[model samples]
Target chain A: MSFDLGLVIEYFPRLLSGAGLTVELIAISSLVGICIAVPVGLMRVSASPTLRNLSLAYVFFFRGTPLLIQIFLVYYGLSQFEAVRNSVLWPFLRQPYWCAIVAFALNTGAYTAEILRGAMQAVPRGEIEAARAFGMSTALLFRRVILPRAVRIGWPAYGNEVIFMIKGSALASTITLLDLTGMARTIIAKTYAPVEIFLAAGLIYLAIVFVLTRAFRRIEARLNRYLLHESA
Target chain B: MFDLKGFGDQLLLGALMTVGLALSVLCVGTILGLAGAIAKLSKSAPARFAAETYTAVLRGIPELLIVLVIYFGSSGLLTAAAEAMGHDGFVELSPFAAGVTALSLVFGAYATEVFRGAILAIPKGQIEAARAIGMNRRLVFLRVTLPQLWRVALPGLGNLFLVSQKDTALVSVIGLEELTRKAAFATGFTKAPFTFYMAAAVLYLTITSVTMVGLHLAERRASRGMPGMRG
Candidate 1:
């Protein structure tokens, strides 16, 4: 059959709303994930063996398993426990939306922690020494010298984590969140036109990811303007 | 509160299927990656653009959507094309085939970058030296390029395969009876979601750790007798 433009136009609003929920899901989870990552990452690089090993275990467990299983475990598995159901946290855990956020945040947190840890280690030792030589306190040294440099060095990879989180947010659909893919699946069920509906869905994702990557590239360039002169 | 009795066989079967699917995808992905790298490196502008777009589009989209589209969409397209070719039958795309195709496409897109880097890492003078020794193009590639490319690409490809292994779980969404699906199935009957999923997670972790050890051994083997190489 030939292509039908009419279906796409008719379904655009529904698809747009789905995309909105997707954006909402991604934005909130990624923000929480980054917040989680920063502390975990710091803990990873800390001198204390207890802290470092605990952070390493956290990263290992999350990174080892598939995200799909993680989502199922949180969404379906957690509710299986009577203690959890009777607890004050049950209200939040009962919702698929919250379960998704929990899973995405935890999973991305593990990855971002590793990225930040690598970036922290990669920061030039000389710069760190200079700050110490000036008698900057540990807090001041990290605030003024370490974090800024680590973030600049790790931003590109962190940008990748953002894109991954977006792509990953699609998994929320599987848990009944009615995100972009969920909307597309619903539309296809009604119209019996999987190709057209899914293509539209895919293109919308492409556009968002395209915009995100471009924005990241600009930020990376702006961050490294000082190094640009030497390279050119 | 947990029992795996009588479910062990099913889980084993599912894990085997997971490995089988991963291997199929790896073969397809490596071929596509090699071809994609060549196209991107080629002089033809159209080839370069096509390769670039392939990687960008595949990498940009969600792997689940790709699997859904290929599994559900291909049947209609294939049937239409079959009719156009004077055939008169409904064509069905197996979930296995669709899963393999989709997973491989995702695998290949990332692999393209790995292969491209590996290829570029081979120095120009080495190829020139091989040519100067009167070696043909095929001999040069087999004797020089292929060996170095394997060493350089192994770590990246090993990581990709592990990621792809987890991705194989996504195929369960499209009705493949892989590890994740089987776990879900058992969870349904036993009403023990945590037990089954945790078991599946441990199984996956086992596969990952085993493959990692294998990869470590392979890296050591490849690096043997080479200066500056580490264990």
Candidate 2:
């Protein structure tokens, strides 16, 4: 009933240990998600209707459902098929870590794609026209003009996505990964101090979010330095 | 090749439960969000600070942790309260209550920002015009603000509704037997995790897709007569 500061203090270090895996999950999934998102996001805004529709369906399915279901589908659903079990992919698929990463990457990729599509579409038409006038090819124009501009525009939203990924990575605990949330649950099970442990865990999450937010603000400022000087 | 083995009805019920939970959270969260937005925009410094802390803490933490904390933490608090009241046995909070409370808090935190932005988007002159017409503060809000707020907040709120619906799946972790929980149960019973989860996924997709269409219609209706605003 009484709050135990000592218990929280003692478990804080253990919770920090789990923070490593949490960060790892977010970092790896987000990197892979960006890779997946860039192509899919480009496809969303592609000139080809087929590419656009295919990417639209991909985004819809992933965004429309819960990430938990996606993770379960990959982790539990896939194993239901004998083919998957016997396949060479089984070794990677059998581990919950890979399953969580795959699901997180796909889910975030869908969201990031939408964000990227909006940013890409919002790129100044004049910039593209100018790029073409300068005799730049499609690839070069995308590389030099559209991609940089879209990234600058999309950075804030993508930062929020990264925060979402951090919060979402907690779901990895459900599939038995000893991420921060899992470690908190394990500590609670042993100590029977759910309130203290969870409170401690929540504080760590808040700290991570706080730090990331500050970092994102710095990056955003740096990215928009040109606009800052123009306004000044 | 996929058989539900008469568990189809259970899955349907679970889907209904999920909707019920999300709807309840939507109602409660909207009220909380309105109050939070007002508090954050209030003149009093403490009210603004309290609102800021509420949103910051709730939004920063993972929803699962909030659920777990409420599930286990509330029981402890309830038992302690009952003890102080001279009750003999331990008290427990139902998983449904805990789920609703946690999810509503999470939803309210996000909705606070949405509502705040929507409120800010209302032209300052409109409120002044209402006041000039001798309308009281309450009347200004009810007659002048609420309608416009709904129009502006609908899209954000609709997105939140979809999110809250999906978040209901997280409640199954605390044993609420929502759609996701039902799929897990069916999987356990039939050893067909793929089929049941796929069914659950399809059911969820249906719910979200239907909700999307409804939101689109609502947005169109809300933006009626506002030229160039209709999507």
Candidate 3:
């Protein structure tokens, strides 16, 4: 049987909207994820035993299990609890969109935290000693020296997390969130042409990933250039 | 309000199924990865391009989408082909076959990079020495290259295997009765989502931890005679 290229063109518009939702899911989740990750990452590197262990446990659990299971736990398990259902948070938890966001955010946050923590630990010890010799306060030292260096070190791996999140956002479809993959699945159901619709969806994902990969590479190069001795 | 009761055996069986699926996918993926790494390293332009395209496309797409597409897409293609051949019956992929194929493709794409890196890590001098000793190409590869390749690739391959194992859960969406699907089934019957999901998570963590320990031991063993290797 021949493939009709026309189907791809005709469905392109719908796929674009689907891609928009995917981008929204990824953008919102990643922003929220980074917000959560910074504190957790910092805590993971903190001197306090309690904070470090707590963050370690959080990362361990999230990274250990599959994202699909986490989504279901949030979407289904939380709703199962009578107290959770009656709580003020229930309104947000009731929606599949919110559940997806929460799950995605937490999952990405765990990964981003680990990346950031690794980067933070990789910062030159002598540089930190130099900063301390200057009598910089903890806050000033962190803001002026550690944070920027950590980000530069972590950016490439963090970029991988972002790419992974884009792919992970496809799981929103499983929870009935009508994201990119969801829309593709819907179209396939209506047209019974899985080959065409899914190919279109996969291609859309490929395009987005290709662009992101290129952007990250450029950013990494710029970051590397800043670190060169001659440039200094 | 949590009780697993009779579902214990089912969950255990599901874990076995998950392991079986992952292992099968690993074997298929390792074969694909070897082929892909060779293609990527080949002198021919077309071979390198094909390998690059394979990794780029497969790695870029979500594994969930791949599973869905392969499950439904192949069935449609197969049915159409059957019809063209004057057959009248339905042609569908069992979820196991589709899951294995999709996961293998996913694992293979990622493993290609790891294998390629491992191959590159082998010293060129060693291969040259083998050639100078008058060993045939196949013998040189088997005796010199293969032994060293596995040592370098083990850690990365192990990590990919962990990812692949968790990905088996995604196949549940297409109706494979792996751990996640088994948990979903239990939740539907017992209406105890928290219990089932929590149990599934624990089960997965157990598998992950055990595998990590095994990999660490294997890595230590592999690095035993190497200089400056640390635990």
Candidate 4:
């Protein structure tokens, strides 16, 4: 019933070891998510109804459902089919690690795409018109004018999604990956000290979030440096 | 090719439970959020510090860890308390109670910011006018502050509802027989993981879509007569 400081100190290193996979899951999924998001986000605002609708559906389905179910669909559901089990994709699909990555990437991609779409739309229309007035091509205008402004606008929200991704990656533990939560569960099973182990795990997560928050604030400051004098 | 094996009713019940749990958490969370917002905005430094710590710690950690910690930790505390009371047995917290506590904490943390922003969005002149008209603090809040707060807070709260609804799936890990757990059960029973999970996903989407429509209508109603406001 009492707090077990000694037990937490003992198992702190074991919990810290799982930080690697947690960081890896966030990094790879975030990288892959950006790849999917940029295109899908662009498609979201495209003039073509078909492309816009397709991306809309993608974002809708992914955003509408839970990430846990998505992970289950990939990890447990995919292997249920004879075709998927025998397909070339089976090798990667068979691993829970890859499945978690796929689910996280797709989930974050949907959220980021929405954020990107909003940010892109919110880009000052006059800026785009000015780029056109300068005779910049569509691609050049998007690259120089729209994307940078959208990034500046979307960066804070994207940072939130990343933090959510970090929290969500803990669900990867449910599928048996030895992430921080998984490790905490494992140690608790052996030591019968759920409170201590989970407290330690929570501390580690808090540390990760704290560091990321500071990093995001720094990036936001850098991005908005030009607007500083106006605000002052 | 995709039969539910007559578990359709089971899944429906589970979906209902999911909705019920989400609504309950939303109600509790909204109250906590309001209190947290007031505390944060209050002049008392200790009250603000406590509210700040509450949101910071709850928002920073994973909901899963919260669920696990509460599920296990509360039981341990309860059993110890029971032993001190001369009862010699283990005490367990029900999955429902644990689920509600954990999810509400998470929901309330995010909702605090939403409510705080909504509260701050109210024009200072309105509160001043109410006070100038001899309204007490409580009456001013009820008649003046609460009405406008909902208009601004509805959208954010709606989004949080969607989030908490999906987060109900996380409670399944603690053995709550919500939609996700029912699908998992059916999957085990029928050995049809894909069919059941896909069905669950569809069920979730249905709930989400319905909630979205409902929120849209609510927002429209709440923002009625507000000039230049987009419903």
lDDT of 4 at A6: 89
Cα lDDT of all candidates, in order?
0.91, 0.93, 0.91, 0.93
DockQ of all candidate complexes: 0.77, 0.79, 0.73, 0.81
Q: What's the TM-score of every candidate structure? A: 0.94, 0.96, 0.93, 0.96
Write candidate 1's Cα lDDT for B1-231 as tens digits.
Answer: 448857877888999999999999999999999889878987899999999999999989989889988998788789999999999999977999999999999999999999999989999999999999999977987899878998889999998999899899999989999999999999888888988998999889888888889999998888778768674
Residue-level lDDT tens digits of model 3 in A1-232:
5677898899889988999999999989999999999999999999999999999999989998999999999999899889999999999999999999999999999999999999989999999999999999999988999999999999988998898899999999988888889998888888888778888999999999999999999988888885686777
lDDT value, residue A29 of candidate 1:
89
Candidate 1: clashing pairs of residues: none
True contacts kept of each: 0.79, 0.84, 0.86, 0.87
For each candidate, what is chain B's TM-score?
Answer: 0.92, 0.93, 0.91, 0.92
Candidate 4, residue A222: lDDT: 97
Against the true structure, candidate 1 reaches a TM-score of 0.94
Q: Per-residue CA lDDT of candidate 4, range A1-232, in tens? A: 7787988888888899898889999999999999999999999999999999999999999999999999999999999999999999998999989999999999999999999999999999899999999999999999999999999999999999999999999999988999999999899889898888888899899999999999999999999999998888
For model 2, the TM-score of its B chain against the native B chain is 0.93
Each model's chain A TM-score: 0.94, 0.96, 0.94, 0.96
Task: Write down the lDDT that model 3 would get.
Answer: 0.91
The DockQ score of candidate 2 comes to 0.79
Provide C-alpha RMSD values for all models, in order.
Answer: 2.1, 1.8, 2.5, 2.0
Cα lDDT tens digits, model 3, B55-109, are 9999999999899889978887889989999998889789999999999999999
